[model samples]
Target: MNIIDKTDEELLAIGTPWWEDLIKYSNKGQYGKFIQNFSTDLLRGLNEVEVGNQFAKSDLTRSLDTNYDFLGFIRRGEHVSFLFRVRSTKKPGEWLGRMVLGYERGEVKIFAASIF
Candidate 1:
């Protein structure tokens, strides 16, 4: 089935693993693994240098808590945006992590992702 056709619960199940990989690779500063499931357009816009710099400079990216809370999701056209409540292992307070998923080349891929 097409990814966008899935219900919120189904979509969350589908997206959780990908989101976990994002957090895992981000904490380890593994750019390749981090971008492995990114959409073509998203991959094209990223570079190892910038991503590495961000990983090095941001405490949040390097210290993400894996035990995150799945807040909910939003469906827009061909995309499903999942929201996560994330915390830093090395800091206080929480942050919002958003991962937007869509189909690319017949597979689910992350079209956009951010933490704030």
Candidate 2:
């Protein structure tokens, strides 16, 4: 399961361990880093809040409970993006996600998620 590419199969393969780690990592108070690496500034709301480590497992589970599926990727400039949609859900249908990445030296950070 590749975190950078974020394919459907990879998201599905994430399993429990990866999700647990992700929750811990984000809740540890690095949400800005997570946002900067996961979603791009091009979409909207790039930086308006502080990382307060407010992510909860219930919220994550609720978000993941949707039937939305990772369809594939679309390339735009330095970003490679993916789309997830849910038709049967009560919420809106159009939500977009992109992978934002930055590199310094050899340190790698992950900022990938479905921003809906």
Candidate 3:
């Protein structure tokens, strides 16, 4: 019931919207919409506003830059992760983020998102 039937490239392709949505929601301050995209395990029933604030920073929201690219991935048995390199043109800064997505309960769910 795993959701990783597609190739590595395909898996990466599926995550593009996730990355975009993160930046978009952060900028818009739509806490509800943002956390809704996360897996139930990620939220753990915590207050969605706090979780959204934890994921986004005020600096990131101030910048109009929203460009990111996939650098590569790491595969360790069932653990598959991809690193995205994000750039802020307004401030001329860069940040790398790592997102892990895998199958749980016959579905592909995002497990974690951390700064790389």
Tens digits of per-residue lDDT for model 2, 19-79 = 3343345445445443443333332644334224234332432343234455655544443
Estimate, for each residue in 5-114, the C-alpha lDDT of model 1 and write its tens digit: 89877787889999999999999989888988889999889886888999889988999999999998787798988999999999999999999998888888899999
Candidate 1 is scored at a TM of 0.93
Candidate 3 lDDT over residue span 1-116, tens digit each: 44445677788677778767766776677766655556778878577666656646656553535667788877665656878887654666677877777776766777776543
lDDT on C-alpha atoms for all candidate structures: 0.90, 0.40, 0.67
Better of 2 and 3 by lDDT: 3
Off by over 4 Å in 3: 1-5, 45-49, 52-57, 61-64
Count the clashes in each prediction: 0, 3, 0
**Weakest 10 consecutive residues of candidate 1 by summed lDDT:** 1-10
Q: What is the TM-score of each candidate against the true structure?
A: 0.93, 0.35, 0.75
Task: Give the Cα error of residue 86 in candidate 3, in Å.
Answer: 0.8
Question: Any residue pairs clashing in model 3, and if so which?
Answer: none
User: What range of 10 consecutive residues in model 2 has the weakest lDDT sum?
Assistant: 99-108
TM-score, candidate number 3: 0.75
Give Cα distance to truth, residue 73, candidate 1, Å.
0.8
